[model samples]
Target: MQNSKWVDVAIVGAGLAGITCGQTLRQSGYTVAILEKSRGLGGRVATRRLMATCADHGAKFVEPQGEQTQQLIQQLCDRQLLQPWTAPIWTVDAAGTLTPTEPTPRYVAPEGMTAIAKVLAEGLDIRRQQRVVEIKSIDAQTWEFTTDSGEALPLQARSLVLAIPAPQAVPLLEPLVAKGLPTAVLETVRKAMFDPCITAIATYPAEQAAAWHRVGALQPLQHPVLRWVSRESQKRSMPGHEVCVLHSTPAFATQYIDAPTLETAGRAMLQAGAAWFPGMEKPQQLQLHRWRYGFARSPDPMLEPLPHAKTPIPLVITGDWCRGSNLESAVEAGVRAASLLEQWLNSGHD
Candidate 1:
């Protein structure tokens, strides 16, 4: 077996949480490595290029709430990495009456939402397509991990962070509990719940695009199938055609989560969307993306990353699921997780 160089910290799931955590730790002079399962970087901050245009199929936009998130947003804006989505957002009630939403600024990237991840990921050591399969505590101050890469050797680190969803993280930590490690943290991770979502991206001809020219996006209230519809082209400039992103209700996603074919589900969502905006049923191009852990259910805003137990090394479990189901929450959690890990290291726990 080949031996790889040990790092100060190794983080799983190169999503927002993992990237943010790694970035913060690196600023503190720690050598960090971010391991991602997917070829893409951002977890939910995704964008798809189909037909002649692109659409943000995962997170529509980011609305900063907390102080840290606001500061991050301002920094991104100053660098021209992000811009305010000043387009009008309207909400549709059950009676089909549309009303303008509050004039709060929603931020988006000019190229795509994934640009945010790319910006934060700059200058970071991120290993993509490396799905961590096993983690074991090697000693009082070291941990080792093996990925699905079919390599004989495993990576070692003084500290580790599981920044993926709870369901995905549980299996990796379960084996450690047998060695008297992370039982308390495991229970807390188990308590976290997530809902699935089915997102549909459709592009319409210019004739149909003019119908909704005044509206930037629509939130359908009390809808059984469709939950949100946004003109993705408005966020950028896509000529000759319009791109729209459709999000299915959580209930609809739950029912179709295990469908034999997702095409049917995608069509069904488009059909429902047509009821609100005609011509959505028939798009020039269509794409579907399913998120298994789309949103966290009733996450406690006051909660921080799960505190480590009396293990030999420092281990942290964190994600958007640790707090709320939003980009801002994920950023806040990552910052906090980095701080906690630093504390543990400073106290000579690892």
Candidate 2:
């Protein structure tokens, strides 16, 4: 990107919302740039490879609740990037009793969760490892953004969209907050809470893998330690490898937030799962991932229609915390924010 020229928009946080906003803005003929804090794209939508196996450590699956999201899922399926798994997800109660609840078919990326974000970011101007430290309005028509690396990238546009979480967006908007905006808006942003989660990925020997298969121990709704588990190699477009992924319940994760050793937790989860597969053995390779802000608990209700102020600047905030806690909600929030921005830009108002 040319430093001298100004893009129409600068989107922060290259997660699902940021990427979706960029795609929509670009389609509307706006020159856009995306800044990401991570080394790679996809914030919470992450996937990892262990030895010869691949596993999804974040965002295990997606269920379309609305027509817009359903259409998006159809598009993804048409591209051969996602496939539907059986419905009625299994759940283990606090007493270790397993129950299955059938709902809509849960869809997972064939490769992994990150595959969906990768497909969305295609042909977009994404700058990884560039974390925005500050954002301020230069004037009525220009905005200035500075990265943590001490690089100043000025974006002169009629609108600005913040696709980061509500908690993170609060500090960034301190100046505006200090200016005495309505307490309700600020309170709503502050009230949005995010829950933490832990994912454990394990790999067993070929014989053990076959043994697990026979016992049907890896069913999505059968185990307590695992919210969703799948053979990585069995997925449609996933890399051919033997691996199993496990996601712990939010309640359990809160208990071990400060645990010294993750292995202890992993072992506990493995032991909890042993009842289903009596002969199951310990994994040869084990990995654990902790997510501090895994999902939102109380998301802002106004997320679908982002709030904007005419006096301050054309600043709009959006994220999964604003709408719902899922990939579809994040994308829908982005699209809605983009639409609001388009209207603001055209009307020359807030």
Q: Model 1 — TM-score against the truth?
A: 0.95
Predicted candidate 1 versus true structure: per-residue lDDT over 1-350, tens digit per residue: 25677889999888888899999999999999888888999899898877665789988997778886688789889999889899998989999999999999789887888888998888998888888888877756677777787553356788898999999988988888887775777888888899899999888887787677778999999998988999987798888888889999999999989887789999999998877678889988888889999988756654654545548567888888777878877887898899998997777773
Q: Candidate 1 lDDT (Cα, whole model)?
A: 0.84
lDDT of 2: 0.70
lDDT, candidates in the order shown: 0.84, 0.70
Model 2 misplaced stretches (Cα beyond 4 Å): 86-89, 94-104, 154-158, 179-184, 214-230, 236-241, 258-261, 277-281, 298-304
In model 1, residue pairs whose N, Cα or C atoms come closer than 3 Å (at least 3 residues apart or on different chains), thus clashing, are none
